[model samples]
Every structure is written in C-alpha cells, then in structure tokens.
Target chain A: MATDSKQFDFGFRNGRLRVAWYALLAVLLLVGGYAMWLRLQGGMRSTNLTSITPWGAWVAFYIYFVGLSAGAFLVSTLANVFGIERLHRVDRDALFAAIVSMVVALLFVWTDLGRMDRMWHPFAWRQVTSALSWEVHAYVAYIFVLMTELYFSMRYDLARVAERGTGLRARLAGLLTLGRRQLTDESREADRTWLKRAGIVGIPLAIFMVHGGTGVLFAVSKARPYWNSGLFPVIFIISAVLSGTALVMLLYVLRTRLFDGERVDRDILDRLATLLAAFVVVDVALTAIEALIAIVSLHPHEVETWRLILFGEMSWSFWWFMVGMGWVFPLVLVSKREWRRTPWLMAVAGLSVVIGIIAVRFNIVVPPQIRPVMEGLPHGSYFPSAVEWATSVGMMAVGLLLYTIGAELLPLTPLDGGDH
Target chain B: MSSNDAMPGVPDTPDRAQLDAMVDAEQADPRAELEDVDFSTELGVAMAEDAKAVSRGEITSEEYWQRYDDLAAEEFGEVYHETPNPAVDHDTAQTIEDDVAESLSCTVGSMASIAESLEEPAGDSEGASEDGEDDDHRWGMVIDLQKCVGCDSCSVACKAENRTPPGVSYNVVMEEEHGEFPNVQRTNVPRPCMQCENPPCVQVCPVSATYKMDNGVVNVDYDRCIGCRYCMIACPYGARYFDFGENYDDEVEGAGEITSPEYGVDRGEREPKKSPVGNVRKCHFCHHRLNRGEEPACVETCVGDARNMGDLDDPDSEVAEMAASTRAMQLKEGEGTDPNVYYLE
Candidate 1:
C-alpha cells in the first residue's frame, strides 16, 4: 500500500473538494429525483413537449450518449482487437467510458418513454418492421458484447489483484475471478482469446447495428424527409467516432492528472488529437453534403426543415457551438502541431469536440422536429425546461459518480507488463 | 328555442284574450290579484267571453273584473296570482314540432339512407373500396368546398362529441385564401383523418398500436400505444396528435370526467395520465358514433352539411357518390396513401 501510494498521487483534492463534489452531486440527485418524480406523476405534461414536438432534449441526449458509447468502444477495439499498440493506454478507459455512456444513454431513453412502465413492451410486443423495435434488440446485443469484452479483458488482472488487495476491491476482484486464484499463462492467454473474440463480434455490432440502428430509427421515418436519406446512418457512424475519440482523450487526462498526478503521455495525446481532428473534418463534410442534398432535393418539408436548422430559432446550436467551437476551434487547436503536443491544448480541443457533438445531436433532433410534418400545420417551438435540464445533469452526475466509484473499487488501470 | 319553451312547470296552453289582458294588467301596475287558482280559470274564461262586450262599451271592463274579483279572492284567500295566460307564439309552437320531426328523421334517415339508399352505387365505380368489408360502417367522408363557408362547425362538433382534451384536435379547418385582394379566392380545406388504404402511421408504430381497419378507418388501440409519438411524425397529413396527458378539466367542468367512446370503446371517465392520456390520438372517423348506426359528431352537427360521411361499402351512399365525383381530390394523393376522405374542388 505504501509503495503504491508513493507510485500514485492520492490527494482526494485535499478532501474538501471531494466533500464538496459529493455534496453538490447529492443535492443535484435530490433535485433531479424530485423532477423525475414529477414527470412520473404528471407524465409528459411536466415537459414542454406537445403533440407537435413529442420528442425533446431527452432524445437528443440519448443519441448523443449512444454516439459517445459507440465511438469509445470502437477506439478500444483499435487497441485490443486491431493491435494499435500506440493507442493501448486508452483501451480500458475507453471501454469503461463506453459502458458508462451506454448506461446514461439508456437512462435517457427510459426517461423519454411516454409510458415508462410499458417500455418493456417494445421487447415483448415488438414489430420487426419498426426500426425502433429493432433498435431495442440491437441495444441488448451490444450491451452483452460490451460486457463480455470488458469482463474477459479485466479477468487476468482481477485475478492478479485478488491475492494482494483488501476491502471491496479484493472482494470484488475475488468474486469476478470466480474464486480462481490461479493466474497461469494459459488462463491469461484464454482471457485474451475471449476478449479478442468479443471485440470482433462487438466491432460490427457497435458500428452497423447499435448506433447505426439508432440512426435508422430516425431515417426510416418517411414523413421526415430531412432524415430519410441513406447518408444519415453513415453520418451517425462518423460523428460517433469523433465523440468516442474526444471522450477517451478527455477521460485519460482527467484520470491521469487529477487522480494519479501523472504527466500525460504527450505522444499519445497528440496522436489521439490528430485522429479527432481528422474525424471532425469528415463529420463536417458529411453534414455539409447532407445540407446540399437537402437543398438540391427541393422537397418542401426537407427544405423547410433545413432552413429551420440552418437559420431558425435553434441555429445557434449549429453555428456557435457545432461550427465555431466544436469543429473550427478544435480543428485549429489540434491541427497545429505545437498545440496538439501540449497536453492542456489537447484537452481543450478534445472537450470542445465532445461539447460540439452535443450541439450536433441537439441540432439533429430539435430543428427537424420544429418544422411541421404537414403544411398549414403549426410549427412546434421548444426549449428545455428546468426539470429536463436538472434530470439531465443528475443522470450525468450519476454516470460520472458510478464511473468514479467503479474506478476506486476496481483496478481500472492496466497492470504493468500487460496481463500475461 | 326560446327560454319559455324550456322553462319547467309553465302552462302548456292559455286563452289568448285573458293572456293579453294579463299582460296589460301586469304592465299597468295593476293591483296584485288574489290567488283564484280555480276561480282564475273561471275569471279567465269570463273575461274571454265578455271581452267583446267590454270592448263594445256594452259593459265596463272594471265592472266585469269586479264581478270576478270576489271569485279570485274566494278561490285563494291571500295568495298572489302571477300566473299569466301565456299567448304561446304560433311560430314557436311550429318550431317545437319541427325540432321533434327533425330529430326523428335523423334516426330514420341514417339506416334507410344506406340500406335502401339514395343512389344506386354504380356497382363498379372503384374496386379499391370493396374488400369484403362489412355492409355497414365502412365510413368515408367528402367535403364540397363550394358549399363550405369555412364555418368550423365540424371542428366544434368534434371537440364537443369527442370531449378531446386541449391540444388534441381531431378535426381542423385549413383555409387557403390566395390571389390579389380584389380577385382573391378563398378555399376551406376541412381536414380529418385520411383513414388511408396504406396509413404510414400504422406502418411506423413500434407496437402496432395504430392500425387500419377492414372498414377503411385507421383506429388507435390506446391500451397498446406507448405514446412514442412516432406515428405523429410519420403521418403526411398531420392528422395525428399526442394526448400529452393534458386536460380541459380546468377549462370545462367535468371535461376530464368523460372520455368519448372512440372507436366504440367506452373508455370511462377521463383521468390524468391514463392509457388514452399518454397515447397518440386522432379522428377515428367518429368510430363510436358509427357503431351506433349514426353519423360522426362532425357529420351530425355540421350546419352547412358541407362535409358528408356515410358507408363507402354501400355504393349508393352520399359520401361514396360524392367521392366518385370528377372534382373530388384528396390530401397528399401523390404519397400513395389513398385517403378515404375526399374533397370537391
């Protein structure tokens, strides 16, 4: 314990910061809990949502988190399955972020359901034709793949730490290894084999099935021509990669600097930032192409919706956040070799891309919806209510807290010399 | 109808001469007559009888009523007599008779109008309508825009009969006023559920909550709907609405207490956040009213009779005949929805 403490800085932010963080989280939980209760009691009436705009911020956040999860998982695959050894440090952290982001995404979905109790019906009484129903099955398959990959990858380490650890960490590690204290090279190799298999299955599932399926959930709505194009699902995949890259980069910095007091690997961050920069360019091009296609198609609904997205009430989300901060600002920072090499600069670029992705998600959901499905029909206007924002903050806080606690209790960092 | 016609415990009939005198007596600040209950009847009859004599100057009206005054006092010692012999307007009486006849004709008109029917359905007008549907209640609607004054009677009737909560409108009157001011042309497009042959709403529903019936109307299964609002987004005509669990309970007394038996399903007293509350709702072509061998509330209550609803299965029906007109059109015809609701331009 003494040697480990010496190796890793463990200040707990001088204790007061830790107490304040928890106290703030606890207060938010209570506030969000009350808000959720109000929603359950009042149904969607508590929301600013109307018959015109049935989906709102909750749905935007749902797709945002789904993108984040898929992106993170794919990054992890780059290290674990594709043998990108330069990006190996991001592997476990990315996987953990993927799992936590999915949990948060699903929580958003649960909150968004009109009949929360009947949410199970999408599974029990599903229609194969509905992309949403198909998404339900996809989510389950993806979650299983993620869990299996994560557990098998962690097993050898869990087994190693089980013999030397104490408290919940030791108990959790002992339980995870199924009472097997043996960490022979043979078992470690088997663990790697299962992880590789899980990652192989998960790669396709996350890309084409999980997040892409979610994109199809909107694309198949023939009524909304703005989302009906084939490019939508592909765009979802590209943007998801962007978010995932940003999340891993951001999480790595926060984890290493604040908790471990370790100087970030400048080489790794530069490489990850470069990847993020490339993803942002692709994402930007795809968005521009979609906009041009919408203009060229000249479908009234599609054009009108695009008009609203580009210059309507919520256009700031696209211009100020998505373009200004998310794309250009981050791109310039990461594109410059000097800035990319700086850890703080890389962190700023990564966080900007992540936040801009949220704006992308919001623009995707809100603008198209604000345009009426039928002409002469009243257009819907929406702004998130305090309850929605509070609930969102609470759920995010919970996800972060869950990840924090899990990090504390588990050996999230890879053991030296690899699992073998 | 006048308030007098609706008033409780009022005299059904009264003598004209006495009614006039009674009006004059009350108008002139005459002394309050003692209650003559039965004697009043006698005095009224007497006044009617000798009214000519008093008017002819053969006998003074004061002396004639003075003779009846003792009779009025003896009939009821101290009660005030305020009961006027109401003249009962001839027009009002005729109106009452017409009301009864009109309502009775509505009942007889619906069944026979379809059964024996007005026109012989050309038997081969369109095969798309004939899918072995039931002989009754294959509801369809046709709107004659020429006759439609843009009077939103259909919208009002729908609101009243459906008892729809606020923000869930089942019918709408879309107005298109175009051209320069002097030469402007105004058109009213009364929109209801298309009840399409290929409803996009049914196709997009995740739970199969909304479906097109064999009878050609798209109906919602409230119990099955998850209130996902996917159907609303899919609908090209924008006919659908989410319930949002809102209520007119605050606006209209007992509005939340009774839900329309839409699609003939008797969903009892409306409650906040119930099945139908969270479900996506739309016009079922007034399914509840259809099952009762009557037209929808909108069809029944439309003042212009601009919108007609009847069995499309019965080729002779008005709506079916109107639907076959050369001027007939539908909303979003290019979408291939094949909407049953038609409009005459």
Candidate 2:
C-alpha cells in the first residue's frame, strides 16, 4: 500500500464537508423528531400499525441498531482483551461506535414503546416475567460498562492531550481525565487492567443478556408460533456477531477514508469479513432448520406464518433483500480469498452484510404479523407511513452525528504507536 | 332463717316444737324427702313433679316425651292416638308459602318468570312440568353451513350490535369453493371469534386481557392489553384481531359515534385515543345482546334462520341436538381450541 502524503493534511481538513454533513444530519433529526411528535400526538394512528401487523419499521430499526451495537462492542473486545494486534488501530473507534450505536438503539426502542411516557416504569416497576423488562436493565448496565471501557481505553491519549494544554482539545481532554494527568506506567497498567475486566464481563453480557435475550423475547411468545422456538435466541446471537463484525469493518474503512489517514489494516479487515461470513452461514443454516421443523410438524399456524414469509405479498423482501443480498452476496464476496485481501472490496462486503442484516431484522418482525390467526378474519397489510420512514432516517442520522462528534472530540484512532 | 323455715311441706306458721320434730326427721334420713303419707297420691305427685323437672332441664325433652308416650301406651293398651301438633304443621305451611311467593316474584321479573309460574301448579304432574320447562331457554348458537347463502348479513348485524370497528369484525363469512369444475361446491363458513372453551387467545394473553366467561363467551379486557398482539398470532382459528385505531369516518357518516358496548361495557363514541384501539379485540358472543335476553346479532339477522342460538348444555335444546348430529363439526378441531361455535354442514 502506497503512503499517500495528500491524505495526512489533518490541519487543513475541509470545514465545508463537516458543515454539510452536520447540516444534513440536523435537518434529518428535526424532521424525524417532528414525526415522533406527531406519532405521540396521534398515538398509533399516525402509522399503519394495524391489529394484524403491530410491529413496523421502528422495531426493525431497533433490532438492527442493537445488532450493530453488540457487533461493534464484540469486535473492540477482540482487540482489547484477546490482543488481536492488527485490529488495535481501529479498536478505540470500534468502542466509540459501539457506545453510540447502543445509544441509538435505545432511542429507537424509546420511540417504539407504546407508552413512551411510562418508559421509566420498566426501571421502577420491573416485571420479572417480561423479557423486555430484563432487556431494559441489561441495556442500561451495558451502556454504563461501555462508557467506562471507552474512558479507560482513551485515558492515555486524554492525558497526553491535557499535557499539551494548547487548544480546545487540551481543555476538553483535561476535564475528561478528571484532573489526573500523570500518564505514568502504573496509571497505564491500571487503565489496561480495567479495560480488560470490562471487556471480559461485557462479552457474555452482550451475547446472552442484551442480544440473545432480545431473541428470547420473541421466541418465548408461544402465541406467535413462528417465533416460538429454542433456536430463535441462538440465531439472534449468531446474527448479532455477524452484524457487529461487519459494522466495525465498515466503520474502520469509512473513518480512515473520512479522516484521510493511513490505510486501515487489510489483514484484520479480512479476518473480520471471514468472521461475518461464518456467522451468516450459521444464521442461514439455523433458518433452514427452523423452516424444516415448522413445515414437517404441519402445524397450521406455523405453516401459514412460514408461507407468508416465503410466498406472501412481502416475500420479495425475504427472497431478495434478506436471503439473497444480506446472506448470499456477502458470503460470496468475503469467501473469495483474493477479493477479501483488497480493503475496498472488503469494505463493500462489510457494507453488504450491514444492509443484509437490516433486511434480516425486517423479515423477523413483519411476515408472521401479516397472516391472520383465523380463517375468516381479515388479513393485515402494512406499509410504513411517511412519518415512519422519516423517523427511521432521522434515527440513523442521529446515530451518525453522535459517532461523528465523538470521533472528532475524542482520541478514537491510534496515535503514533505500532505496538500499543 | 330459722329451723321452722327449713321444714319441708310444713307451713311457715308451724309451732316451734313441730318444726323441731321435722328438722330432726330431715337430719335422720336424706331419702325421707321422698317419703309421704299416701303411696298412690305420692306416685301421682311424683309423676307431676317429674314432668315439671323435665321442663326445667332435669332430663332431656326426648326422655320427657318418651315417659309420657309410655304412660299413654299403658293407658290405651297400644290404642292411644297422639295427634300431630297443629301449630307446628301451620308454621311449616306458612314457611312454604313465603318461599313460593319470593320465588314467584323473582321469576316473574326475569326470563325464568313465565316458566316458573307455568310450572308452579304443574309440579304434581310430570307431563305439564315438561311443557313448562321449555319456557326458560338457555341461549346458544348453531351455524348451518348448508343454508348460509354467504350474504354477510350476519357479519353486518354483528357489527351493528357489537359496534366493532373496521378491522375488528365480530363475525366474518369465509367462503371456500372446493373441488374442480362439475364437482365444485361452495361453502360459506361464517366465523365469529369462536368463543372457544379452550381458546388459545386466552391461554397466550400474558396479562389475562382476553378470557372466557361463565356464559361460554370469550371477551377482551381492553384496559389491560399492552398491544403486544401475541393473542392474534396464537389463535389457530384466526379469531383474535388487534384494534389498530382505524375508523370508518371516510366511508360512514357517523361510524365512530356509537361504539360497541362489548361485554356490556358502554364505551360511548369510538375515538382514536380510547382503548380497544391499541388492544386485542375479539367476539364476546354479542354479550350486550345476550345480557338483554336476545340472541346474538348474527343469529337474529340470518334471513334463512340458518344460525340457531340456544343452550348446548340442555340436551333437548336445538343447538345441543344439532351439535350432536353427525353433520355438525367445528373448525380446526385438531388444534384443540374446542370452539363453542358449531357449524352444521
């Protein structure tokens, strides 16, 4: 890879691009916020959420962002705890993205809650039986752990900036360090120790409590025979890993490009792509098994739900978007050893997986709802209203804005060290 | 206070010497209290005394009665007739009359009133009693598949009676045309929310929002539902529907003006923000009409009289007898929903 001198002009970084991106994000946020306000005012009437199809785009986005958050955190943990040195360059950015993605996921869920005003009720009056209630607690705990982990990971960089004390970055860095700026060996060791512990604890929590628990939420619903299966949670865990690895790979490439910095480690990106491919393979296998069981049982409700997923009006989303684009294409792109070696090709594969995961979340939520439970009952048909689409875009923009702001203000990338 | 007062059967004005003699005799023998001048007169006195003792709790009333009964037996030599107490007999008759009057008033005011009165005097005869029994009919429903012309009038009537919204239909006729060409036969199965005895909707509802009632109707508690839509997915019969806050305002002049008083709860005027909007709703067997002593809207408005409503528990009732017929069947019986609504082919 050629060292491009033009890419290292950090001082003369364009104010124009920054302003444009920020303005676009701000506009999306405003529009989405306004739609949310409308949704609150009108209740569920503003959207096309019918008795037949209760969940919609908001729920799909909720799980999508959750998968991204969980995925990013897992990747960061791989570098920090497992000592995957090649990934160390993008580790800080991965952690920051994980935190931001989680925040975004929380925001999506906040919007999805029927009684957003009583959102605090889950925290206050915890229902032990509700999977959603447990998820609320797990998410809160995970966010806290993420923030602590990020703080520790950035401690040495923060102290260095504070020692310089020449600009706004120094002042912010000084405050972030909480007035402790020794940057001693002992302090470094302590930071590393805490980061390792947080990562170690967070790994299982992210897999089992946060993401896998989300799968359990739907799986335990015996009412929806389509979602009622033991494999559902396991599939969720696998998909989360898939999405998380893909998200980090995409983020590393995009951030490196945006900053006009040195080339991202292609070997690590390849490894991440391989991991994502493996997860996709597992996810596809689990889905096949689920379908086989459902079909073989000849359970009418389950059969109908499966038919709706495979052959119903919205079956195109399942066939093309989810199975074809999300799984097959990404798998093929990453599986090719030569193509995986190229950073841009790897980025494309990662992007494909990310897009594919979104479709996966959608397919999980919608198909079962469209089929009516009884023969004579009217079948539900749903399409997101303008407000739903706008709000979703706004949510994505907000996530991006958070990530951008964090990246700019914090030491999210490696600084002058190959061995750190 | 003196020794003269202690003398038994002696006058209070007895002389001091005579009282002294009586006291001496009392001290000599405790059994002397029973001793008397004439044996036969004393026996009669003792019998009278025993009777008094019995009344005062000296012996059980049964013993007193038995002693009297024995004396009567001896006197009459098994021919002594003890007539039944007229006061007791009169009290019994009065109590019965009061009970009859109370029952009559209640029956007259309710559906069973005419039946109770018609059967009241016919208690002595089995034939007339059977005739009167038919008056108090327990309401049920039997949907005939053969006669249902697939007009959807039953569904419309149900909507009018139940005030179900656009997406929440209490009754829907599913038309299935089976076979090919010349062998084809069209069957219109009007499905109400099954009102299943073992409803999966009720089973899967986390908060017990939807439940079965004593009158064999499945009802939804709008207030408790969290809009999870789990019941809708669980129901094999596809009987449950979510209230998505839809209205017929664009189509009807005042569709939202009158909301269904489902389960006899009159929630006046359908509105967007009200409950049952974001809740799961299902057929309650036209609970409001049933409460008012009328058949379900579907059964009443079936122009062909194909829908019969009666008590299935009563073996002789039309619904029960029809349900027993070989032609009668229920939808998705293999799923074990045990639907109360029977369809006759």
**Docking verdict class for candidate 1:** acceptable
Query: What tens-digit string does per-residue lDDT give for candidate 1 at A249-305?
Result: 988887777655567888788889889988999999999999999999998878888
DockQ of each: 0.44, 0.16
User: Which candidate number has the best lDDT?
Assistant: 1
- What are the per-residue Cα lDDT tens digits for candidate 1 across B155-214? 999998898888989999887779998999888888899999888888878887777778
Residue A292 lDDT (model 1): 96
lDDT of 2 by residue, A1-420 (tens): 222333222221467878888898899999988987888787767778876677888888888888888888988988889998888877887888888888888888777655445456455544456576678889999999888888888888788766753566667888998777877989989998999999999998999999988888788766567888999888887887888888888877777766645576677777887887888889899989989999898988788888878888878888888888789888888878877777787788788888888888988888777766555556778888988888888888889888887777666775543355
Assess candidate 1 and give its lDDT. Answer: 0.79
Q: What number of backbone clashes does candidate 1 have, counting pairs of residues 3 or more apart or in separate chains?
A: 0
The candidate that wins on DockQ is: 1
User: Per-model i-RMS in Å?
Assistant: 1.3, 3.9
Least well predicted 10-residue stretch by lDDT in candidate 1 chain B: B84-93
